[model samples]
Target: MEKLIDCHFHIWDLDANYYPWLTDNVSENVTKITGDYSSIRRNYLVEDFRKDIGDLNVVAAVHVQADADPKDSVKETQWLQSVADGSGNGMPQGIVARGALNADNAEEIIEAHCACPNMRGMRVEMHPGLNAPADYNPLKDEKWLRNFALLQKHDLVFEVRAASPEQTKDVIQLMRDHPETNFVFPHLALSIWRDEEAIAAWKRNIKIFGELPNAYIKLSGYGLFGLGWTTEMVRPYVMDVIDAMGPDQVVCGSNYPVDSMAAPYSRIWETHFQLLDDAGITGADRAKILHDNGKRVYKL
Candidate 1:
């Protein structure tokens, strides 16, 4: 059996009233942080995750923010710590909670999450495709950058997602501007490798992040764009990401529950390994992607 740190997975309780997007009335497709997600309406908790990753030899797991109300983001981390305390499963050793980098209360929220023994960092999702109000456009604002810099002071990581490669380019300055705070870019930064122009631009964007030692990228969410991702579809892009970021800077995440909608948990890991194997990623280097990188980056 292979051991892993499983950098990403999500567990939510519909009974908690924390997740607005998980409302039971979601009979049709609903847009959460990711995209049009209709299949994940059901409540998913720690036990459900255990079942999904059954016998996969996960040494630990990192729980990223699950789009719960921002007010309850700290509480969400507390609840997950409780889950970890009781699960006896040796999972959820780290958490990436939510906090608006542009908010006046950003430091308060960041400090609150930092108090949690398991909290690793914070993430903000800017969905430019939806024209998310004036507030979501804080990436370039001085106040947002000021609040964002607080992550370094507290030794916390920053994870972000932009709607397009062009938007990703806009973050390059932020990464270089904040060298002390580490950043994690997930899902090939939503690169559409099938298109030549998009892939070329994505490579350029990725290369910029690669130059910044603090920036990291997660090799997950291969099918996030509703196209039903396959290894063939994701290989060139994944390899390109590795080429830019190198194995040590790359971490692999299951993006479970959300990714499970497109492919089962086991299948997702299986195909990801196949991609690595084909790319000639060494076994030791493979261990870094599957486990060490996550443990070191997340400080699990």
Candidate 2:
């Protein structure tokens, strides 16, 4: 197997930490892209993750925040850092903790997260409502933008997801406003794979995002493409992202545990390899998407 660096994955201890989505009854408000998530609701420690990967040579991996309680955001980072320090596996070499950019204590929380040795960045979800106007978008809110700039000060990555056209444009503007802060777009901008028209819009928005020097995209969360999704079914979506953002700006992640609902860890990586091969991305370029870009982007 080729070397790998999983830019996205999660290892949550349900008993140790409180996760509202996983613990509380599944909310109807949550999007059901992959239908039910009953299979991955339990704790997924480093050992469990290792067992899943088995022999795959994951040189390093990033642990994106798994929606722990807002009050425990910094606690989550410290806990993961401890896990990385003790696991000896050196998995989750980086921790992308959570911080609500609009919260009054956002900067204080960010400072606490950065204090952790494994702190790399944070994923502040900008669910900019469907087709929200520039004036109404939360991302453009004065307090939020001021707090978002804290990431730049710490030289941290901002892993974001933008679903609507207006939100994508807002992200583009945000990038322009703060070029110093690196942006990693996860889950193919959380595309609506079931709709070709939505995919077309995603393509247009992704192309615009690619033009920004600070923007990067992660190819992950195939499970979100819907249950029983084929490699062929999602190949065009993958290719379009690469076409827009080149190998250098793109990175790959398992979106594991969550994606485990769709397929095994090995199968997930195999699908990623197949998708890249289908796109004719081989040699160093292939290495870039697989692990190199991840190493550089996450400083693993």
Candidate 3:
């Protein structure tokens, strides 16, 4: 079997700190959202992840931001870099740390994160519906354009995580505005609620994004879409994205821990395997989605 690179995995320890957003009202679809800190706080160290994959060659991994405190975001990257440096495991070769793109110190935050060896990019989470309060609208043009420019200045890949389809246009526009910046749309533009109209709108948006040479898409987080996501259930959506973006522009991501609520770690990988097999993607294409593309995107 070909080696894999899970480009969108996350690891968190609730005991270490707090994930304030983990509450009853977090998201109705996620069962683990209801669990207490202990239930959610299992040790998921780099070694644990390696053991979990067993024979599967996790040649490298890109650690996506896990919505912790902004300070903890930098700490998480440092911890992962230490692990990578000590053990020499190629997994976790890059980290996508968090920063308030709209914050006044955005450049400073990016510079601090980039100083770390494993820090490859930054994730500006745009979960407007879930995290945005009634008064807070992220669509304001000034902050949006300023944040996009910061990513370009630091030469960081921007990971856009919009919770709703309506926000896709804003993200795409940001990409268009900064033709030099590279952006990765995590979770297939994050339109996983199975809302037909929303999905359709996202498809149109993605088509436009696919034309942008600097854009990439991550095939991750199927579990977040709904409760039971078998390979067949998710295959059409995944294939449609692959068809739209082509294999070179897309990559696979495990979205682990968060995905553990819907299915165990093993099932998540198995589902990905089945989807790629059913799609008749060649081994080279599988390598690109699983490893090569991530290496290029994250510069791992």
Candidate 4:
């Protein structure tokens, strides 16, 4: 009996002419999205994802927003729904569609995504990178906050993606200001580092974000930023996150296709699971971190 609910992953078809982010020109322009994304630039439907999991016993999955063009965000939701419907067993029972928080028609885009039967919440990629807009100050902007209020009105979770340590600070403050909206922080609070000072700051900030009762952390998306695929490569960070966020607010995620850039599905999941075991996480508490917490957080 496989009993895991992967909280983050993606499925896209570049041939479908939908995802601008995966298009040739876009990939060329934003080369730093990862060290090398060429290996995953092809189509990856639900079946491919299922193949990757290979006996991991994934009962359900939650598809997080991929960086398709903003106009096609709702289309991505629709595509995932079709994939689930085709699968008959609901591979992605929940869909987190991308919505540009500062866009003029942000409400319309959110509504369009919410209209989909499987849509669960919205994600705005303010990861602060070369791909990120130079002028966008999501943490302090009026447009960003005003648009975020819409999530409160519609009862949607706001999935935050903080790519760097500086961005992590911004996400922490966002959660503090909007305690009403349930938040999902993916990528280990976006804290991947090598320097001692950086690790210390990230740990300190993790504690700050973890204390807030309004959010949950999805531990996924490793190896994408030059990190290796060994258990030792991730063990310290995994234990650190578990200690800070606690099992109740920490959920396991695969971050597939994107994480595929670093390692295969089995490798990442194995690494994550082993870390939990090494940290003495077992029984219902372990189940909560692996699957049960994802069900509760995403309302699966």
On TM-score, the stronger of 1 and 2 is 2
- List the candidates ranked by TM-score, beginning with the highest: 2, 4, 1, 3
TM-score per prediction, in order, is 0.90, 0.93, 0.87, 0.91
Name the top lDDT candidate.
2
Best by TM-score: 2
What's the lDDT for candidate 2?
0.83
**lDDT of candidate 4 at residue 130, scale 0 to 100:** 35
Per residue, candidate 2 scores C-alpha lDDT tens digits across 1-300 of: 688999999999988788887899984434455578877778999999988989999988999998888777888888898888888356679999986787898888888999988899988766534223434556668998888889988879998854455467677888999998889988877554446777677878888878888889998988887778788877887889989999899999999898888889988888889988888999999999999999998888
lDDT of 3 by residue, 57-127 (tens): 77788888776665556676666666668763655788888867677776777777888878878877565
Off by over 4 Å in 3: 21-38, 87-90
| Collision count of model 2 | 0
lDDT of 1 at 165: 57
CA lDDT of every candidate: 0.78, 0.83, 0.72, 0.78
lDDT at position 264, candidate 1: 82
Which candidate, 3 or 4, would have the higher lDDT against the true structure?
4
- Candidate 4 residues lying further than 4 Å off, grouped into runs, are 26-33, 128-130, 191-194, 225-227
- Candidate 1 lDDT over 1-300, as tens digits, reads 667877778898877646766774442324544466767877888889889888788888899888777566778877887787877354689988886777788888888888878888887766544324744566656887788778888898888855455566567777778888888988877543347788677777778878889888888886575547677877887888889998889998888888887888888788878988988987789999888999899998
